[model samples]
Target: MVRRANPAIQALKEETYIMSAVFDHGEFDHHEQIVFANDHQTGLKAIIGVHNSFLGPAAGGVRMAPYARMEDALTDVLRLSRGMSYKNALAGLPLGGGKTVLIGNPRTDKTPALMAALGRAIERLNGRYLAAEDVGMTLADMEQIATETSHVFGRDPKAGFGGEPSPMTALGVALSIRTCVRRVLGRDDLKGVRIGVQGAGAVGADLARQLGEAGAEVLVADVDPARAQAAASAAGGQVVGVGDILFADVDVLAPCALGAVLNDETIPALRTKIVCGAANNQLAEPRHGLALAQRGILYGPDYVVNAGGIINVAYEVSGTYDAAKVVEHVQRIPRTLEQIFEEAADEGLTPDVIADRMAQRLIGRS
Candidate 1:
């Protein structure tokens, strides 16, 4: 007999319908559900969002964080899964959306056994949902999970053996940023343009390096002082406090950190003309894109700019991984951004709307 639906999963299904009325195209099959488990000993709680399989399988990352409540984790998984859908669609990948979140701090709660158990739980999905690295996941952790299951990505050669996706992501973001700069600043080059990059993570550091190489004055900030210093030193950029990054006097603000950094609180303080980055779910809500446009900030949709890693992983999952193909896919960001910007301008619609329309077209074609 089939099991009864979990209350959390039922609530998520209801919430998705509510969100669809507002955002649209967030359809999910009945087979999709949020799986959860509580490990009192390891103090690990997780919610896995297995959203769709229309393209192939549902693929996304497993993030571990200290969520205040299970509802927070559930909401994040649903939203992130939806983003993954658009991300894969825009990148022309044959995969749907799914994401998993572990409720606990990664630094203290992440253990080998915990990851192994998570992998086992992933294995229970029977290849319908594939998990990989994300905000709180690392290559080593992925390696440990690989021991429990073979359904994970991130080990693809195209990922440079789990190296930073930042460069490729940066390449995409930089290309779009350069395009935005050209349209706004009337210059095709990024030389002498001041850029403030938030979060000195793998992606952020690589972005800073690329900006510096392009002769853009790069400034960086991160919560981790060591990482901030390292990125700053490597890129010959100045380091600033994490909270001070949004207020920097730069041509662009690259939020390479967590999502929802573009909410009302930070948006009013933003002094940049252009916003582009490798971060996912940059907007707290769909309406926030409109807010950014009203503020005259050229916001590059996070999924559009940060699809490099997914593109790389898709190539791997398809058994035809090629570095050149990956680069070609990454390079498409500028063209996509340009098209979205043009459409948004021509129709006087928000960028998020344009992106969703484009993604919906792809889904319909499929």
Candidate 2:
């Protein structure tokens, strides 16, 4: 079962990967719904992946990424939406999973008109899916989207909405790292702990500051020098070369940037005792989880540890956006990771596999 992308959308998605115009619906056939949005007037072409809604309304973020093909975008939204389902369920949120993607270069293509068109497309879905800020999308963009539809989250704090979830996401990852460190090395605090953070964007910058506050020596690496410098300034950290983040001899390697950064090429070079972060799909493949374990690295699955953002916005979806409650909930992320660590040790499975099983049990019942 496959649907080829229309010509208009195909042309819109070719800004990232250099490829032909071929497109398909991708491999994840268990999706609850898939919406292809194209508004010629606004030049908005996006795809929303609603992976599951049995637990509650599907909630996730909208990312504007340059993709080579429509199929690449679909594949991403589907996987990420499904990951959100698992992420929310494990975090004890009363929400399911969904996500979106606007195909274009965020640098020069973003506009209020495009954002509103995406919002209208989301409005068509009613409450089946909720939107927040994701990669390449900003809170200001969410505001423009809100002008067209009320089903938006992550607006500016001045507007009295949930605001950006990246800080919360970074906080969650820090807590998860503490959990991993405590259980693995019997440490009580992060003081003097060496942490290498890849990607110093919104979430990474916050995570770096959190690490500094916790007394950890932070090394930040980003492809963008300006972003790397800002992160270092934010956390009083040192900026490492981009190639060093994956191989540096740090106690914990936190990936705060893009997904699939940890692959066969880099896994063998990791010297960290703990692998955790705010990036989704850190493992290039499922087998990479076991690889981390085989090398004696305590692996904290991406979805499990980086769920603070979703937990923050989940409240907004339910109309009870409370800051304190969100923080309290995020604090429980470490306990959740502790349980997974214990279970994985007993069952000889990686934390990623354990987490997936836990989410599947709930998904199956739902």
Candidate 3:
């Protein structure tokens, strides 16, 4: 029997209303799928959100986390899938938004057999949904899924054309940071800016390296102490604890960690002048972006800045992966950020609202 959702989960589900505006304007039908594994040892639960198929097949990432309730997973999948839809539209990919959330901790619950079972579940969905790496997932996990299914991304080393999306994503964030510095701090270069990066994963580490190369002081933190130390040492920066990153006294707080870090509680405590990174769904709610603006923080929209990965993946899936094309798209992030910020300032709205408007305009929904 499907369990009922508690109040907190219900509230998360309701948050999808903000995304509903774009979907309603586009007039796309949305589909939801839920899966439960019968394995006694590994009780895995998942929810897949297919927000639209107006363009082509639905594509997004599979996020795995230990949620306290099933409703939490459902809310995340729904919101993230909707974001993917907008992301595809803005990136000019012939794909719609879709996302899947495996309701368990990746640390202890993920197994080969369980992954295979999840692959079977994906196979059942057929071509309607394609999976890729997201929070709590890796390329190795995608490789495992490819053994059972073919509709996967991030497998083609050839598709990268000698450079993967991770670096491109970092580059996008770096460029946005530069733009933020110039606009918010009146500096044209990141020669000596101090940045506190909250995740030393692919995107965070890459951003840290880029910042260091550009002569920016970077402070890094990660749940894995070793990874944090390695990134900090390599970048010629200092390592801080994961919890201390949010309150770090730096010019920028780059959150490459999981989504929804900028909630009501964290928003009030942020100490950085700029908040920009490659993570998706950074805001716990739309109001958080407004709060950042109110606090004089230059906030870059997550979807706009993090679109480089999807742009690269789109080129790969289309069999026309070109480094120049990926670079062209990734480089546009700063311009997009500038436009969004300018529009937000002019219209007295949040960056996210302006970004959504731009995405809708690009997708022909506005």
Candidate 4:
């Protein structure tokens, strides 16, 4: 008797072949799927990149930005999606990595119709990807997306448990920074320790507040002067100029902004003992991790430190959202960082490299 080939298996083979060809160009990173979506009526343009699904459905946030070019939007989505994969794996969440980028200014261009269109696009993926809140999006914006689909996380608060993730993200980064201080500075407390926080957005502001509450001296900076002043006021911190934040003479540098800030030029100027924050893809490239290491900087791999937000959303996805459980899970972040640091020491490798290898092995990439 002859048997028929499973359609899913055949589809996987075809996808593998196509991806192999795309990989040769050095842009593709073994992503399982990429979808370009447009809606003429709503003037919505978006790209969704699903990096992997070995653990479960791809889960990530949808960020809206007024990217100057389509290519820039694509690059951000690809890098963010890949980062989500490593983040989830390290956090031990039963979810894969994916991300969506909406190419428009969220403040001026966002509309209910546009969000609905984006939701429909997510529905078309048939649960392969889940959308949550990210930069340029809010809980209310997520509600707009939820109007069209059920495959969404980081929704409105349920029984006052799960909602926006930035606060939790800040908590995780603060804890990880404390861990770094302990490891590199031989201090268990943050008392009087100076911390320079770049990007006074949601996560950065909250992180500055947390650091201040922990007895650390927080210096805040942002592209927007108002935001920087507000964050500094809230945290009782000093507002540093954006240009000088990177070179602030501090014990720690927390880059809570966009990616690629730790490039060739910034690494030499980083005047801190540790590099750790809520930013995704903080290292401009893999080599930048080694460069940080070479400079005697203890880098707390960004993905590992920023998993609290994802952990919170994962609980929302599991159908039973428990605030306590989510916090407990986030608390494990420092332990993971400690393990990564120990392994890096033993292997004589950068923490980021060690973390990437560990996450890759978890996701069947290695």
Runs off by more than 4 Å, candidate 2 = 1-29
Give the runs in model 4 whose Cα sits over 4 Å from its true position: 1-25, 158-161
Error of 2 at 241 (Å): 1.1
Task: List, residue by residue over 176-240, the lDDT tens digit for candidate 2.
Answer: 98888888778989999999999988999999999988899999999999999888877878999
**Best candidate per lDDT, number?**
4
TM-score of each: 0.88, 0.91, 0.85, 0.93
Using TM-score, rank the candidates from best to worst: 4, 2, 1, 3
Better of 2 and 3 by TM-score: 2
| Ten contiguous residues minimizing lDDT sum, candidate 3 | 25-34
Candidate 1 lDDT over residue span 114-189, tens digit each? 8888888889888989886788888788878878898887763444453334456767877878988987788988
Worst 10 residues of 2 by lDDT: 15-24
Better of 1 and 2 by TM-score: 2
Model 1 earns a TM-score of 0.88
Q: Write the per-residue lDDT of candidate 4 for residues 1-366, one digit (tens) a residue.
A: 999999999999977874554455345688899888899999999999999999999999999999998778878888899999999999999999999999999889999999999999999999999988999999989988989999988988853437989988999999999899999999999999999999999999999999988889999999999999989988888999999999999999999988899999999988999999998889998899999998999999999999999999999999889989999999999999999999999999999999999999999999
Residue pairs of candidate 2 with colliding backbone atoms: none
